[model samples]
Target chain A: MARIKFSTLTEQMFYTLLCLKEECCGMDILDKIPEMTDNRVNIGSGTLYTLLEQFCECDMIRETKTEGRRRSYILTKTGREILEKEYMRICAQAEDYRRFFSGDK
Target chain B: MKDTKRRIELYSFFDHSGIEKHLEKMAKKGWILQKITNLFWVYRRANPQNLKFSVSYCPSASEFDPSDSETKNEYNEFCRHTGWNYAASGAQMFIFYTELENPTPIQTEPSLEVEAIHRSVKKTIIPIYFILMLLAVLQGAMFVTNLISDPIDILSNSTSLFTGFGWTMLFILFAAELSGYYLWRHKAKKAAQQGEFQESHGHKTLYCVTLLAVFIGFIYWIISLIINSSYFELTIAVIMLFAVAALIFLVNGVKQFLKNKNTPAKVNMTLTVVSSFVLSFLLIGVVTFGIITAAKNGIFDRESQFYQSLYLDSPPLTVEDLLGNEELSDRYITQISGGKAVLLGKYEIRQYARSGDSDAKLPGLEYTVTVVKARFMYNFCKNHLIKNKDKTEGGKVIFADHYEKTDAAEWGANEAYRRYRSANYVNQYILCYYNYIVEINFDWEPTASQKSIVGDIFS
Candidate 1:
């Protein structure tokens, strides 16, 4: 079957999970995404957390600890798996596109 | 009025305040207050030509923003922002967009790093679901074990917390849990699809704990009974159950306390070393049991009094009597017995809960009678209410569940919307014997409304 690109909703979810892979809480997540993108993309705390929340809701983000004020999110095995498949999917799709249209390298 | 079907529509959940400040933000996205419906604010962008949608909230936008009146611009921006076949509504803050061919869930532009996390989350939940089911099974086994051993064990523990006034309420809770467990699978599907983290979490943890608590109560009984020589044994069993449940709560509570320190409600005196007082006072002397038994006997001087004490019908009918539809049911039903309306009608139980399937813990059957009220008999069988006693039917036994009067807020939930969302698998049943059906007495007040306001419009 032909591969497809990630939608914006999935993009928000993936990046939020990546940002949350480390010591990111709700506030940290709110901050890190804008910094990583250099202000190019900005999403609401509700929207960003809502997507990562789906991961947590699905038990994909087991909580670690709450330090001063924020609850931290760590990637679950399921989260890591989702990330990997999306990565390979992009790779496979890019490879197919290049092979058919742009040849070498 | 147009013969054409209306356009795409969707609804959203928001903190009432957040939606107020962001009305224009939402309005620009093609949402506006609904004029007609009660406690509902509608949002529509029909092209005036095709699509239609509605959103509902209790208070209108005027309740919040007094100054800025117009909301047209927000609707325009929403219409221009996306390229989709349709969008139904964007009420409060959530935007629900639908396309001609519904969009496949994917991220269009993702960095290599971001792609990896999604793959991992997918793998983790498979086992989590399994672990959750196992936990549920373990919890159910505990209830079964306890019921098989002693019905009085659960009754006593419940009476301790709720008192005699709580029997009906407790039964309701048990019933809700029993029935709710079946519908809980819907939660798994709904949680996976919707973006509400809190509801999803509640569904997961409550399920594990409900069955677990009953299990703890069951085990406590056996241990207490064996070590009955000492008053300390009973105390220890009670305290131990309380402690284990408390410990689980305290661990989670302490974390929440630290996170939400700014909120005053979080300052709740969550955990304490109150066992010292409990040990010192020692309420487990033979006096306590003597008093309870005496209360049971003395309060009901006559057999009629006995029925009143247990909130049962005066003339106890066998399961056969309730099932067979005897003629006496007609004689005593409509008359004004003693000053009250004698309600004796057997609702033909033709169940029609299309939304309720076998996957549902409760089959969602409603009694076809005077009216189907969600506030009646709590279902004990659903949460796999354990039966150590004789089964009237092949595997059914009747027990009173009287924990319905608990204020939802006391349980740390909003009472209006909580309903029986986290109840163990108990359903309210009308067990029919031969003729007269022993069901919820209409005189009995109920737990809060069976329907929840939390996700009412959408869920």
Candidate 2:
């Protein structure tokens, strides 16, 4: 049973979790990430495949259906919790930056 | 004739980057790699095209599997869906090529690729290379010990010397190859952490040079066999071939054992390694026993006709001549060593004597006479013994002298030759008579009269 090793989410990991909020096949997530990130981040198929395997192994994602080699996965409850925690962390950092800017003004 | 051709080339097993580059070059030249065999890569001619090749390692892939299983096929299909077409595979390595304008890389995640390669290396190359290096080191230690104890014996045994050198070269090559892969992996990991791909470095030049050296050594070894065409050499060649075959069989056995997917990979890997080691020990034991048995029944049997045949056809002075008018004292004669080849003949005899018949002749007069019939063999024996005498015989430095006679007929010898004392062991001499080299060692310094007698026997 591997716990999430990363203390903080990488951009790809965060965006991938964001896309999996709705049930989506692996290939679709690859396509959706670029559109969602405004082309700032592009996840290669190999990266997505490996990350999906790792996520499934860590119980962060579960396969809902498999049509041929195309697999559809949804974020597990554990995955949603981790994603929410990461979102809160990013929000706190943004809040600190805002406070610093206002103090300067 | 088939439309395709096969080429035999030597490449380091772990040289993924170099291999992909080479395949790409070949593709441009219209040669498409179709399959890989033990020592060759089969290729089919195709229209020249620009192709990108990617090599990867899968721990589950095996050399023993005759056909791809369902899982392997599915894996290949998965890669195909991504535009990477499977080209060839060997052991744990897989190669894929694509002509697509924009092809998805097979290994997008560097860390995962690194882990896969690590697993494959651990399962295959590392264990075998480590064991071979250990054996090479052990062999080198043995050679040093032997040279120290009996330099003369090591000089006479060229097979062991060359074998030791060959093993040493292989060990160095393996070390270079292994370390190159390790350093590449380390750098690759660091680059991957920065979201960059690092190509695996391959030692193409080192691999080529080592292979060329081995090829030349193999040819020289064969020439040596032909020059020294003795039954002993024949037996040794047979044993060597058997050992090589047994090793291949043992490796295949491990691969076949690991093919059963029911067992965990870790457990399978452990079992494969343990069994390979045990079977290798068994192989060594069997080969050693065969060699010892052949040696004992063949050369060491002084009474054997084959051993007796190496002696002189006609001797001017026999054992009886040496006894002279003195009492018989003590006499012991052993064949000691003997070999015969197409152009060379070798015979060694160790004889002991004492002035009295009692056993008090503890370190009595000992004679070690070695007779070699051919020029090459004689020269080899002479040079090695003389050049290494000081290092091999470690004791008080006594005296050394040498002389040559251009007029051999006047000296009562058949041909012109030289004689030298390596270091005073009482007396140690390397004397050439006609085409033969006759080395004589004695416990007491020989007088002029005794020297003439020995020379007369050769003449």
Candidate 3:
């Protein structure tokens, strides 16, 4: 079997997965991303659409509903696992920086 | 009323961003592109508005595919959901446009977009360029060999000059365009890796100029050939050009036809190749038949004024006319033949006067008469003669003793002479005459009889 394509998630990919965790419409991700990151992470509609398709192909996300031209997707078990792992990695990195600043070996 | 405009379509092969920018600017000018052809881009009048245009290259998007193909339908649906309206597509390029202010770009992932462009260019552009470069190299090698064997012929011949110029220009343009694509791709990839979108800045000016030059050269070459060559040659040239064009279309059509059937790509490719080869073989057969028919009809008859004047009647001067001896026999041969109306006064005749017996180890003569009608041609020939005055010919420094004489009322209006002799051979020459220059080379000093023959011919 092919290995998971993106071993490390880009900022857009991470945010896209984060938006899908709530079972959101694909187009809504474009707006929710900027709000979720306080306007710091803005995912273009194209990025959202492409990421959703790739996620579906890799079983990381599944489309839950379609209305006309709109599609809504939710994160899968695999997607949740990846997101949790990324969150833990980020926390561990912050912890190391915190310890270093506190003069702990 | 829909106002339409047509402008020549000129763009570097891989300048997607530049094309988008151009389209956006045109939209602002109230002209939106409707169609593009090999020659021109057609545009329709539209309301002036700020719009965003995006171009994406999809290598697998076959031009021959039906407009509503599943792949196209899926792509259209995806873009529509994002409010990116489908505009137009040609070959591997798909265009989208939207009037939304700050509308999302169609390609947001820079690295994936860059990779897609790279893949498309490699699939479509690289192989054609490789073939073009290979042909240019082969033609260049042949040109160099021809120049080496007979520098004079290659320089003086209009066909050779035109072909050589065209091929060299094509080679340079191909090299520049190929390298330009790769260089842009390299820069774009690096910029993409850094999470930046790099707009394509290509050799647009150089590409346009070279394309124009090549187009002009091709037209001029064809017209010159028709004007200056024999009917037979013109027929062959036109047929060759048409056959090549037809073969290219046939091959492309076969591939596209196969693709439209949704055949497996590998099998379709193989069938396209095999069918094209078979059809090409048939084309060769047709060309051969045409040639044979032309010859049978005496369409290649060489009955031009030059041929009639030069060969129908015995030459005013010949080997026998120039030299008279019972033991030293004479042999005559015509070196060059054929003429056209456009080449009226711009003509040269060369003849060889050799001993009858090759084993006898005797002297020979080379006679040349060049009628210089064109001023540039006259200057070129004069310069060539002057520069190569002491050049070795037939293992002898023939033109070493160059001298001028005005009193050649005996030979012609003016005269130049050179004479050289060695143990095994003698090469002596006098290039003299009126507006038409005559050159005579004798292996040994001309006998008294030969001297009078030269005077008689010029007179």
Could you give the C-alpha RMSD of every candidate to the true structure, in order shown? 23.9, 7.3, 7.0
Lowest lDDT sum, 10 consecutive residues, model 3 chain B, at B338-347
Residue-wise lDDT of candidate 3 within B179-237, one digit each (tens)? 88888878888998899988887677877887788788788777766666656667788
Q: How well is candidate 2 docked (DockQ)?
A: 0.29
Q: Tell me, by DockQ, which candidate is best.
A: 3
Span of ten consecutive residues with least summed lDDT in model 3 chain A: A1-10
Q: List, in order, the clash count of every candidate structure.
A: 92, 0, 1
- DockQ, per-model, please? 0.04, 0.29, 0.30
Output the worst ten-in-a-row residue range by lDDT, candidate 1 chain B: B334-343
Candidate 2: tens digits of C-alpha lDDT, residues B408-437? 443355543344455323345555576556
lDDT of 1 by residue, A1-105 (tens): 001222222555666777867766666665676689886655443344335445666666777886544467788776777677877777898989988887544
Order of quality (lDDT)? 3, 2, 1
TM-score of every prediction relative to native = 0.25, 0.70, 0.72
lDDT of 1 at B42: 51
What residue runs in model 3 are displaced by over 4 Å at the alpha carbon?
A1-7, A15-85, A96-105, B1-6, B38-40, B63-66, B249-272, B302-423, B426-459
**How far is B150's C-alpha from truth in model 1 (Å)?**
19
Would you give me the overall lDDT of model 1? 0.36
lDDT of 1 by residue, B1-459 (tens): 432232222111222223333333444454443331222445544332222221121111111121121221222222223222222222222223333242311212223112222233233333444455555455555665665553323332332322222332333334444344334335434544454321211132343454456556555445434432123333445555565565556554553444334332213222222432343244444446654675575642333322221222232322113333353332232211110011122222222222433333322222212111121322232122222223245555443332232233322232211112232313332222222222322212233332122112112
- Native contacts matched by each model: 0.00, 0.22, 0.31
